[model samples]
Target chain A: MSDARTALYDDHLAFGARMVPFGGFEMPVSYAGILREHDAVRHRAGLFDLSHMAQYHLEGPGVGHWADALTVNDVATMKPGQARYNIFTNDAGGCHDDVLFYRLDENRWLLVVNAGNAAKMWPYLVARADGRRDVKITSGHGSRALVAVQGPLATEIVAQLVDADITVMKYYTCVETHVCGVPAIVARTGYTGEDGFEIFVDSDAASELWRNLFERGSRFGLEPAGLGARDVLRLEAGMPLYGHELDESISPVAGGQRWAVKTRKAAFRGRDAIVAELEADTHDRIAGIVLDGRVPARDGYAVYVGDERVGTVRSGSMAPSVENKNIATVLVTKAASVLGGSLDVEIRGTRHRATVVALPFYKRPTP
Target chain B: MAQPAGLLYSKEHEWLKVEGDTATVGITDYAQNSLGDIVFVELPRIGAALKQHANIGVVESVKAVSDLFTPAGGEVVEVNAALEADPALVNRDAFGDGWLYKIKIDASSMPDALLGPDDYEKLVATS
Candidate 1:
């Protein structure tokens, strides 16, 4: 199959972005460079084209109930204009996909899922909705486009393009408003650790929105960031990527997302399996490792202690923001997850010492 | 991309400046630009012997990691110590201060396949 392109493909090209294939889409990996782009998001503001993320709209009577049954998050408790991070678990208790549940109204809902999992998630949702007559699930995959403005100044910059007052918009909330005269859903949510807003608009108006945001955001130092910067930012923030940290074989609970799983609530797909794992003490857990040198412990590299293979690295990098630290997220045995425990990562056939550090290597100072 | 005159280049994108038996080695402008924002560089130990086109070290950028291949067989005499603190020199001055190492070339073992600037320019253009 041919790789897909986002609505802002031309815009990325105009910006001289290096394109790479990601999630079956030809996406921009970097613009000025990953280091500069990553620094911009942490120090100032950075714009990102997130149009490839899958969007599904579900509305009708009992929609919230249906969504609650399918997702691990407590959907029924979410107020209008609120969004909650959730996970769709298979019957085996492994994560089908990590999703964002946007409660538009009492009966209307929108689910934003990872780009790679869109096809699988769509069919899975359809199969679950087979006997249900009240909820309607509509795919908005290629029809909508998403642009995120993230950083310390993201709110101030995005406020200039939108009609609504977003300065007071709390995190994880959204409002349907007009951005640069284009109808959009302005949400105070982002993957970066910094404060930000994600604006969702029609695909056709994406370029206009991007241009206007760039023009208005120029004074605020808003540069166009790419997936390369986004990856490091999310990793530093301790958020897990789907194929890396949470996969079809990994449960969200083991992936350090137990907060999203409402175990006390009624039964959901994979709830029993997840609960069973939680009851067991032998489940592997996700932990952060700080390597001794600059050589990163890449994915699939084995984690060791003495002669024992304890785990494997999920994501690793020479963190751009943190000086002299090579950070990695590893899936290790529960016993090896103790904070400050020493371990070894075999990088390219060489053993490197690593320490079990805190999950988030970086955190934004709350203002 | 700038390919300095009088420097011998390899198909692997490494450039070598030969002076007597010692040669200074670094990647080319095309190589550094393609790698993008080199954050770390691992160099070979002084006195270590290497074969032509052998993996001598590694260069890491924010986007990915690439192996640095030796252009000619030699024994490492010295390595650029500045890269330990700031690896961006590889992106800024890949042909000069970014030189990875200096090696005493083995006169009898020098590879015959090294490309001149013009030939390397053509090679890079087609690639």
Candidate 2:
């Protein structure tokens, strides 16, 4: 509870935002209202302060080999200025953390780690530096703050605001450009399943950039979204949250992150254990459910089938923008993983019935 | 911030409008404004008896769930069924169309506990 607050504390107080502790930081859960901010990200764009996340730059020869062995994604083939969402797993195939790897050039890469486990992932990567004479490890340096602007109109609004030409940056790509006179890097990757960009800049200048974004994007219905809306939006997008879906205790095979696992090549840290688990048929799987009604089957609620308890819901919400129903991701036993399996969430001393459904309760219209 | 001239509000933010033996109870305009979105409203059944400041129902927002307590003791005469189907009405109109329930109140205890408009406004300003 005594964790140091961020630089945006004053801004949050001025905006009358309700602050709550998350990942040990006093972060805003909502401002201007939850549904109002939620709809803004879904319909327009949202400005999220991602300053809590940790970033690092890796350089020198054979960095690709180090990255390829460190993460579950195919980072060796990443072209210069390209970014790929990746996952790092333990020897038991359990994910240590999920990260985004950005290729700066040959033998140089930038990685963004989760807030809580940023320091934890650093040692894991450093220990696996494949035959490197020197590997630079810098965590939380130079106020490497980031802002995620996500929605259908995010690109258009950001392009209008930043001096950089953000038009040509393809999805999962990064470009070193000046945004609003601040030297920054804009990456076309985000948690919400929409056309968006994540901008990285200095901390002292981030608030100004954020204020500028809101001022310019106000005409397009942009709102300052908080962690509350961010959670629901990511859930609706079926994107796996770090603590909910990936943690040190849960293996990637069970966390529904096999797409990021590259087991076809030489063995990585978690490759052996992942192969063994994939061959076996005992591990639990993550499943999505759209509850029968608007009442959410929140975190830690039980998931059941008639008289049998099968799983527990990790993250859930009654989506605000569209589908306005309770949707949750559940860690279910293998037998209860079927789509038609019925379930119920015990909320407020009442059991609300639900049904197992497909993922991505919401997605942007294809352009 | 609007506190109707005639209505009495509770410290917990519930408002009551007494008309003869019946009292209409709902959260105040300030309460709804602070709560952001009203996603689900769970109201008590008609004919249920309740005590003053007792838990009558629950309201679920996207962020959290809050318990709803009544300001005065009464027997539920009628519950707002429209709110159960569309809870957003509470956000759109917290006082008029969003009135939660109508209770035939115990007329004797009604006048002493409720806060007047000026008092409720001052209470919230300090909070």
Candidate 3:
């Protein structure tokens, strides 16, 4: 394994987890099993050691306008303590990375980026950040750690473990408070589609907070989930991954994230190209396909629109939590991107029928 | 978990139980453990001739798709039909009702060799 150790390396080792190199970090792949951990998140709650994701804090007199220009989403109207799901694109209009921009204060904000692209994204942001805009980029990947606690009853589970009113913070809002007397940033945001909170804290105190929270929340059926469960949960939730569902060659509008890309604005990195491509309605698209059987079509499996080679499956898995069927997100045609469109994937040598469905296979029930 | 005695194992983590010239084949406990949860299994058709290490079947779990290899060169006689509706049986009782197929051995000792419990155990430990 070429990846380095995170701050919670010892904690994962203590839990008897299988660690593997992911994006240059020795991350836990699974503790018990992928299905068991997936079940833990579906039935009750699961805690994830998300300490590997990169964090950047930006605050200044002109943070909103500066940050809004950097990302595709219009963040100028966002209030303090609110967060937006956004993405950054390269000069070719290809997605640089998908991230969440957290507005911590009037001038302070936190941008959580994908782990593998952090080193690439950080320097890109630094070079892109015009000092005249009065924006300062503070890299916190080494200083901060994060955990995602998610499930149907995630709010009550977190409520029992935290002293702050995290339950009423509303979705996409975060509040800084203490958990077991450790200062933490509790944000009501998650990729699991389930109601959940993400806790961001300093590196020195992260392990202790993870241990205490895992112990206190265990009674609520919380399992210390790893990357395996995280993949399944987020895939079920229909969230886009950095390398799988997107990359430098893929367009963000293809993933139903065109809302995040503001066209009326003056210009960002990929503004001109994206605006032109939107007008032309180019060649690629991202579609959700639910398989007929349980065999998960792998990453590179070819997709055929009735014998015609249309596209390829990107991320796929047997969605045991939803059904025994294999669910996948594939890149297909703009003309054939409509929901209920029938498609087939070549699983080994046979083509299996699959239907394009709406995202987030399972939605958390409101309490 | 200890490898169940009397079950002939394959290097690919499949187990075989011999009864006269007819042998039952299924994925071993190690295979199930590595695959996480078994959701589906695609079995070989009856009377299909298979050589040792041939891809006669495929096991689908939550994480991956693994090909089921044959232990010996033989003709597939019967497939465990229970897998179509309930493939999870492979994970629940891999050595018992979870057996995938039965093949008629071509010779006295069959065409190829199967790994013993000790050999299989070492293979899993290292893997």
Candidate 4:
């Protein structure tokens, strides 16, 4: 099948972005350069087209109670205008997807799923919501667009075009407002670990808002960044990517998202399985690794302790934030995940020395 | 841009410039551009013998790792040392300062698959 194109497809091409097929969509992987774009987001601001992510519009009084049962987080207690990270799991405790829930209002919410999981999640939600008369789910996969501005200057650049005083908007909060005269849901959230805003608008108005942001943001050094840079940024920030860090075979507990799993809740999908794994505490878990040299540890590479293979790398990148060292996430045996543990990543048959560090190889400084 | 004149090109997107029996090798501009920012380049050690069309080393961008092939085979005379510190040179000037290595070859036995600048430009254009 031909890949789907986002609303900002032309905008990406205009910026000389290198496009690649991802999650059934033709998305830009990089524009100027991964490292260059990464640097821009770290020091300045970077514009992103995240329209490929599936946005589900949910409404009805039963939405909260319904979602709470399906996800690992407490959706029923979320206040309006709040956003929370959540995960849907299967009976085996494996993740369906790692998603963000934006509570737009008491009876309405927006759930954003990974682009690659849209096909699976849409049907899953439809089947789950079939018998519920009060909850309604609408797929906004192609009709809406999500644009994000991330960096230290993200707020300053986005606040200029937004109608609301986003300067005071707390992180993980959303507001319905006009941006560049277009209706949008402005949320103070991002995956890059930078202070930022994600603007959600109709597909038709996406180009206009993107162009306007670029025209204004360029003056403040806000250049376009693509998925390649986003991967490095999210990895450095220790964010869990759906496919790599949390997949159908990897549960939230094993994926290092134990904090998001609220066992205190009455019941949820995969609760028993996840709780079992949590109590067992013997499952392989995700760990942070920094290579000793310049050689990059790629996904699927074996991680070893002397002669015994202990794990496999899940996501790897040449981190620009962590002093230009190579950083990776590896799902490893419990013993191999100890902080400061010495491990070796076997790349192309040779073992490279590495140190197991804490999650979030790079953390943004508090303002 | 047209492929630099007088250089022979390989289908793998590498260029070979023959200076008598010593030939300089590097990836074509198209390869570098497609690979994005090159962060590391693993080149064959000096004195290593390589076969034509064989994987000799690797070129790594931030997102990917691509095998570097030897367009023409022989004994590796010298590998670019500067790339150890600055692999982005391959992205900056792939044909000039970014030349990956020099191989001591039998000029008369150069592979027949090498294309001229014109053919290379066509190859890149279609690619």
Model number with the top TM-score: 4
Regions of candidate 4 where Cα sits further than 4 Å from its true position? none
Score candidate 2 by TM-score against the native: 0.90
**Best-fitting candidate, scored by DockQ:** 4
User: Between prediction 2 and prediction 4, which has the larger TM-score?
Assistant: 4
Predict model 3's lDDT versus the native. 0.83
* Candidate 4 local lDDT, B6-116, one digit each (tens): 899999999999988899999999999999899999999999989988898999999889999898879999999999999999999999999999999956558788999
Clashes of 3: 0
Please provide, for model 2 over A1-367, each residue's C-alpha lDDT reduced to its tens digit, 9 standing for 90 to 100: 3755665667777778888877657788898887778788888888787777777878777677766776677888889989998888788888888889888777667789887886577677676664567555556533677888888889877997666678888899998778889888889999877789998887888888888887888788888888888888888888888889778878877888777787885867788888988899688888888888767677888887777888888998887644587788999998888887788777777778888877767878887
In model 3, the clashing pairs are none
**Candidate that would win on lDDT:** 4
lDDT of 1 at A253: 86
Per-candidate clashes come to 0, 0, 0, 0
> Interface RMSD (Å) of model 3?
1.5
Query: Native contact fraction of candidate 3?
Result: 0.87
Weakest 10 consecutive residues, lDDT, candidate 4 chain B? B105-114
lDDT of 2 by residue, B29-115 (tens): 788877778888999899998887789888877767889998888899999999978898888888889999999987655746678
lDDT of 4 by residue, A163-254 (tens): 98999999999999999998999999999989999999999999999999999999999999999999999999999998888998899989
**In candidate 2, which residue ranges exceed 4 Å CA deviation?**
A1-16, A119-133, A160-164, B106-114
What value does the lDDT take at residue B75 in candidate 1?
96
How high is the TM-score of chain A in each model? Answer: 0.98, 0.94, 0.95, 0.99
DockQ, every prediction: 0.74, 0.65, 0.71, 0.87
RMSD of each: 1.4, 2.9, 2.1, 1.0
- After superposing all C-alphas onto the true structure, candidate 2 shows an RMSD in angstroms of 2.9
Rank by lDDT (best first): 4, 1, 3, 2
